[model samples]
Structures are given as structure tokens and as C-alpha cells.
Target: MANIIITGTSRGIGFELVKLFAKEGHQVLALSRNVQPVQRLDLSNVHCFSFDLGNPNDFKKVEAFLEQWNVVDVLINNAGSLLNKPFAETTIEEFERVYKVNVFGVAEMIRTVRHKMGKEGHVVTVSSMGGVQGSMKFPGLSAYSSSKGAVITLTELLAEEYKETGPSFNVLALGAVQTEMLEEAFPGYQALVTALEMATYIKDFALTGHKLYNGKLLQVSNSTP
Candidate 1:
């Protein structure tokens, strides 16, 4: 039904999202550093490609893909890097690496595809509960949480800057979901929400959320991991 681009589609919520959209007959571009998982699916109306959010060259792949279809109806910035180490032990390079994927990467993707998105397009960025101000904070997530926070601010600014032109922006500050990323961040912690559940919510929102929301930060958390 729409031309949608989703990152971090190798696993978790992103992977589920690809399936849902393609099953609904939408044109889907599924991007991930590891594309094998998506390739294995071989779903109809879906294309998989290897992409690195931290690599500038990889963005050209997105542009190349867009040559087939100029417009992007929806973009879900779902890729993220997490560092669970203590703040004191976290090096500057390590911190930058997280932001490279979580912060700067989101910015680059929006800038690269903004032209393709008209007033009706929507950009949904997946953030974490730790990124929300006054939300429950976690230990050993300085880099990861801070980077997510920055993306939220960036989304707000982008929405304000381009409100008149269209392509609204929104950020979803999610709580713990039972996904590999969550396990890597907090071992043995089981979240109430499943990856599929979150993915379903996100897909539904990305398709229609822009109609009512722009430059808004939504806290989508029910439990902690």
C-alpha cells in the first residue's frame, strides 16, 4: 500500500515489522547489517539488503533502492547500538560508536530521504524509556540512553523545521520488550511486552500516526527489563 523503509530488520521488532508490512502488500525495504536473516524470509513485496547505519557509503544503497520508486511513505529508524558497561569504564570512542548508530545515523537517514517524503510521509524513531526525562533510569546505560535522548530532541527539531512542508516526525520512547537487544543490555530480565507486540503497535502507528501527531514524544512503556 505504501513504500516503507525499515532499518535493523535482522531481528526483534524490526524483523516482525517487515513481515507485517509485506504481508499487507506494502513495498518494503528491509535494511540491516546482517541481511541473511531477512533473506531467509523471502517474503513477497519485500526486499532485503545489507546496510550499516554507521557507514556513510552504505547510505548510497538506500538512494539506489529509491531510484526504483522516488517516494518513501514511511521510515522507521529502528536501528540502535547499546553499551551496558559502567559510565566510568565507557571510553569516548565507545560512546561515539553508540551515537553513530543511534543519533547521527537517524539524522543522516532523514536528510537522505526527506525529499522523497511528502506532507503525508511519517518518520517514526524508536527510542527507549531510559531516554525519556523523569522516566525510570537504569544503570550502565549512559551512552545508549543519552544517545537515544539526543535523537528525541533531533526529531522534535526536525518536525518544527519542516512542519509546513509535511513529513511529520515522532519518537516512541519504549519500555522493555522481550528482544535480543534487551537481553544484551540486561541479562535475565524478562519484559512484559513481546517483540511482535511492539512491532505491531509501531507498524500501525507509522502508517497513520502522522495524521494526528507531529514532533511529539510518546512514552510506550509498561514495564522495565
Candidate 2:
């Protein structure tokens, strides 16, 4: 049983991830902007916390909670924001908001927990396939994609910097998964992959992928890569 920290667990992929991990007997620290949904689940192994990732100040609460656990086996940076708008029409505020949650938020979370990670610790940050240079790009996702691109770079740098520190870092560039976030970004579009399916894969990867993969950017999709 590992101690896992997963963010954005109120719903969607994060929610499913919490369920999967908790059901498997892992101790899960599930963080979300709102904790009501997680609390309603009443899972014995899942502990819920509420905080806004866009605000770094909110992480102090997370730190306090971590003080009690003392050790973390996996940290899944799954919280994210999306803004689908043409670059010409996108405001600076919108761009900043995306970066706040997608880039800076992930950085702060990692900083808060890095020292508490055990020898088998692994850090997984979820990016988007749209963030990849050669992947299919949509015109209106400049801000979102740019922020995700930054996450991939950040993960790579962290892995290299912490190569001998025991905790392995990796990034997962994911394809469109059926979730509220995807539906909001692309109305009426159907995703080939479901959030539950992605969550299952993530659970397995978080449990053992670090043993063989580090500093790697993996692409996950049901479509042809």
C-alpha cells in the first residue's frame, strides 16, 4: 500500500483515479478545489482536502497535512485548466490564469512534496497531446497548449535535476479523454478514450512505471499516434 497524492479529484479523471487507488488499498490524499464530492464517496482509504491550485498560498494547508503522513510514494499532478480561444482574441488575463493552474501550480505542488517523497516515489504530470510540437493542434487552444508544453519541459528538467535523489519524474502527454473538461473545450466532440480507462492506466503506471521509466515523455491515446 502506497501513500499517493492526487490533485483535482472532485470529478473526471481525478475522481476516477482516487476511486481506483483507494479501492486497491492505497492511502490516497485527494485534493480538489471542492471536497464535497469526494467526501460523499466515503471511501475509507481516501482522504480529501480542498484548495485552489491557482493560488500558491493555498498549498500551506497541503503542507500541513503532509506533515502528518510524513512520506509520499506518488504525486500525480493532475489538476489543470483550459482556455480555448484564438490567440488574437485571448486576453492576457486568460493566458495567465491557464499558466497559474497548469504550470505554476504543478511546480508549487512538487516543491511542497519533493522532500517528503520516499525512495520509491514517482512524480507524474499530465500534459496534452496538443502540447507536443508534431501532434494535431487546434487553432483555439494556444494558451492551454502552451501551458501544457511548459509542464512537459518542467518535468524533464526536474527528472534530470533529481536523477540521484531517488524520486523519478515523468510526463504523460494524453489524448482527448471523455470528461467535462474536454467537452467544455470542444463542444459536441466525442473522445475516443474515457476518463475511467485513463485512470486505470495511470494507476498502474504510478504503481510501477518509475522502476523502468524516468525523464520520459509518454504519449497515451486510443487513436493512431
Candidate 3:
């Protein structure tokens, strides 16, 4: 089984992903600010701890874990910070907070893990349809959507920069899924996709998608939210 590292595993798609990988007999390092939810699962193969992307100190914890695990087969940047407010109302501090996690934090995570990743490694960054240029843009997401867009470009650039060394990089521009983040950002909005369904797809892609694709941005969505 592959060694997998997943972020934001407290709930939603991230939480489901931890369960899937662990059940498959893979070694999983689940990262989330609220680790209790995953800790309760008690899976021997799954190790989890409190991880906050915005906290610079949290990266040290990952570095320590890598010392024991050594190599990383897959690293999924699933943690995101969402800010929903009118463009005019959004403050710089608030905007920077979202970017701190969605953009900068992702870059740091990749940097920390790339040394341990070989040619077979895969890094999957979860984005949103809203980040895709020409996708339907919604209001009250200036900071959130823009940060996601930055990540898409970052993934592409890194893929080319590290093309020869391996550990292919990709981004998934997902449509609206019934996640807590979605519910909080857009109240009363119903999504046709479920978190578990998306998590399953992400799992499959993370494991083998690198064979067929590298530096690819897949827009996985039937409907825009």
C-alpha cells in the first residue's frame, strides 16, 4: 500500500478520504486542526494530529512525521480557507487569511514533502470551478475564488519546474459538493454531488492519475455552483 498524506481531514471530503485510504490498508497521515474526529476512528494505519495550514509551526510537525515515514507516495492539499463577503466589505486582513491557507500554505506543503517524493509520487491540489477562468463567477467570493485561482497556476508552474524529477502535480477544479464549506459559503444551495462521491474520485486519481497526466487541470464538475 502507498503512503498517503491528506490535509483537512476533520470533515467533509478530507475526512472521508482518510477513511478510504486507511480501509485499503495504506499508511495515512491525516492533518487537520481538529484531529479528534479522525483520532476517534482508531485505524492503526492512519496517524493524525492537529494541523493548521496557516500556522507556520504546524509544518514542523509534518517534517517530524516524514522523518519516520521517509517517503511519500501521495500528498493531497485539501485544506482551504473560505471567506464570503462582498468585495467592498472584505478587508485586506481577511483576504490575506484566505490566501495564507489556500495559496501560500499549499506551496509550503509541497516544498516540505517534495524531497521525500519520488517519480511515482503524486500531488493533488483541490480547487473549485470558480477558480477556473471563464467559469461562472459568484459574488461574495472575491478572496476565496481568487486564492483558488492562484493555486491552479502554481500547480502548473511546479509541474513544469519538476517535470524531470517526477512526483507529478495536478489540480482538480471541482464543482459544488455538499460540503460544510459549501453550505457555509452559500447557504441553502443544494449540490448534486456529495462529499463522499468526490472523495472517491479524488482517491482514485491520486493513486494512479499521475501515470496518464502531469501538470493537468481537470475540471470535475457537471454543474457550476
**Candidate 1 residue lDDT tens string, 17-127:** 999998899999999999998899878789978999999999999888899997999999999999999999999999999999999999999998999999999999999
Residues 5-84 of candidate 2 have per-residue lDDT tens digits of 99999989999999999888999999999999999999988998788999878999988888878789999999999898
Q: Model 1's lDDT to the true fold?
A: 0.94
The number of residue pairs in model 3 that clash at the backbone is: 0
In candidate 2, position 39 carries an lDDT of: 98
TM-score sort, best first: 3, 1, 2
Best by lDDT: 3
Q: Would you estimate the TM-scores of all the predictions?
A: 0.98, 0.97, 0.99
Off by over 4 Å in 1: none
Q: Worst 10-residue stretch by lDDT in candidate 3? A: 62-71
Give the whole-model CA lDDT for all candidates, comma-separated: 0.94, 0.91, 0.95
Going through the candidates in the order shown, the clash numbers are: 0, 0, 0
Model 1: weakest 10-residue lDDT segment is 216-225
* Better by TM-score, candidate 3 or 2: 3
Two-way TM-score contest, 1 vs 2, winner: 1
Q: Cα miss at 67, model 2 (Å)?
A: 1.2
